[model samples]
Target: MGIHIIKMPDLGEGIAEVEVVEWRVKPGDTVKEDQVLADVMTDKATVEIPSPVNGTVIALGGEIGESLAVGAELIRLEVAGSGNQNGKTATPATATATAGTTLPGSPVSTVCERAEELEEAPAPVAKAAPAQAPLLKAAPPRARGLAAPAVRQRALELGIALEFLEGSGPEGRITHADLDAQLLRRVKVAPSGPKPSDPTDAERTIAVTGMRRKIAQKMQEAKRRIPHFTYVEEVDVTELEALRAHLNGQHGNQRGRITLLPLLMRAIVLSLKQFPQANARFNDESGIVTQYDAVHIGVATQTAAGLMVPVVRNAHKHDLWSSALEVARLAEAARAGKAVRDELSGSTITITSLGALGGIVTTPVINHPEVAIIGVNKMVERPMIRDGAIVARKMMNLSSSFDHRVIDGMVAAQFVQTIRAYLETPATLFID
Candidate 1:
């Protein structure tokens, strides 16, 4: 009977605008108070906007992948009594709905109910709906399915047709639980007979939005502004690996198990003492390079969503185990989408590694306005002549990149060599 307008809430940290990544509710969808209406992406993270009062969605503020300024209208809704829009009352005849059009006392809810009914029965081979069909509709017997963005992504990856599966969530919305159930049912019913390969060309066009878009823009800016020069050095890490294994064996239960990353972090922390310029940020606008004595190392981690860099604050303060624990915790938080804004930013330098997948060398891009990034390559056993005799040693390559504007080539090489020296001689890491 009344109109309510919800504007985008300020996501703090002076973010002026945000990209609309997903819409949980569309026009005509009834939303409850505290129900998430949309998910918007800030530079650092994705934030959900919730409804303050129960209402029916009247108009969406923007399309998916569109950017909206702060204080811009996010959604308009039809509510009971007087609303925020000058106490205006929305007429039933003028109410606009799209796609999943639902009129008052319509059979939309019944369609969802029928889908739930089918789910309770034995597994039925349902026909897949056309890809362009609206996911939620009021059609008879075969109304389409509803799911969250994450669930839909996972379903897409697994080649599961959402229309064929029933959702157990509110209003029959599909969830990760439903996905797991579907997988279980699939495994149980799989036939032992040799199945013929049925492969068809299916194209999917995914709009670049959310975290992916942010990553793209950041990477583009960094590449455009910085003149990067990479330096690669091979280090024998046999002693370091041995020391890590011994420490893990001794303190596996008491303290957390030690990984190569903590040892490398310790080496980096120590190396920063000698070359402080590497631990610095550059402001291209002012042409000023600010150096920091305190080292905040950014560890580049790959999550299901995309690449994320979670900073390990004050790396100079933490011991090897403490650093390892912090790195693990931060990486886990980043992967689980629980990392706050502070945890995702303010790094003096960055470290990137692909673990076993790291090949011979890599030219890692600098995390701009930072000057340098250290890349870690895979370790492999190779024949070497150390004291004029053939022997096997675990060798790994340290491929690092630096901004040529501030850091000289010699200084970059010296920084990486310092880290290699500390790693090659594991005892020195504990000395200071």
Candidate 2:
């Protein structure tokens, strides 16, 4: 019998420390090799630390929200095997499993490398600092009404004045659904709202911590450091919609139902082939821009755990049906907070949509380091002029933001125009 110490492996380039968000196993719990032990959040994504050998957990490194340096002792295990006595930790197989049971909507991947791997890895090449503080909107007062602690916390974060909120939980306790309803109601507005006022006597103050804090920091950094230029354009999707319905009808029950996103994604990938500048990343520190051959599209999805963007890798390689299925799979996993870390990173370009709720003209901020982000707006049926005649057609808007330092105005306009052309003519997507 021997004891093995599992240290936090190098999470990624330049990430020297991480926060322990959750622990899966406790002392005296017997765990198997490759089983998840803890969830650690890094700058990029949340990663799952898997146990290296089958053993009984004797101790944990830290509590939730505790930050630990990489290579620090994470877990102490008593094993019933040999070859681990030399202080060498075994690496899991190349097949890494995703654990969504802990935090849904967040990617969780097993750490499969050894300490030496961390040493051999090169330092992170580029660093982008936050340009300014995040501009947060006002949240509502604390509900003096009956509600669970979790419900109350969510209400405060969303700035919902919950004093008048109706409760659906047992004994009139407030529920998560109720809070969501309040949030959606507030989101539907004619213009951007004002900043939230200071807490009132009726409001309960909730501390900003965990993932919420991280999101605020990143957004601020991107907005302040990068000079953003937004361009908005409208596209006619009547034929595209018809073709989508026809394709879905043909697919029948053989595959997942197709959504407008995959069609839009296919169009974007084809457009990137013509304008690669939009599909690249810029390093502010080095003043260098790196273009990628592979198209990894980040789909910004809203979930119960704030907003999470999961990447659809090698998107250009998949067909319409396959792209639809991949989008659905990645979205579902993200919604459930079960996406893996790899699924959340390495997006050269991003596409954000509100689905049916997509409104008109959103100037989405560019995900830092990445040069561009494409926004999808709500599709509306309106009167149009065609063939010297007025008729009703389904129309939508494509709103995009670019890093002005990397992409010029002409290039950005041309890039979006190309996407407009592909979407206007649905058949063009099928061709090489």
Q: Which candidate's TM-score is highest?
A: 1
How many residue-pair clashes does candidate 2 contain?
Answer: 13
Runs in model 2 deviating more than 4 A are: 1-5, 25-35, 51-60, 75-200
lDDT per residue as tens, model 1, 1-432: 778999988988678777788899988899999999998878757788999999998888766766676887789988998878753333332344344565554456568778899889899778988889976766666345787665686688789999988765445667555665677677667568876575563333445567886787688779889999999999999999999999899997899897888889889989999999999999999999999999999999999889999999999999988998999999999899878878999999999999999999999999999999999999999999988999999999999999999999999999999999999999999877
Model 2 lowest lDDT segment of ten: 91-100
The lDDT for every candidate, in the order shown, is 0.85, 0.79
lDDT of 2 by residue, 299-385 (tens): 998877667888999998988778877888888987776787788888999999887877887889888889999999999999999
> What is the Å distance of residue 210 in model 1 from its true position?
1.8
Give me the displacement of residue 57 in model 2, in angstroms: 6.4
Candidate 1: the clashing residue pairs are none
Off by over 4 Å in 1: 87-204
Clashes of each: 0, 13
TM-score of 1: 0.74
Model 1: ten consecutive residues of lowest lDDT: 88-97
Evaluated against the true structure, the overall lDDT of model 1 is 0.85
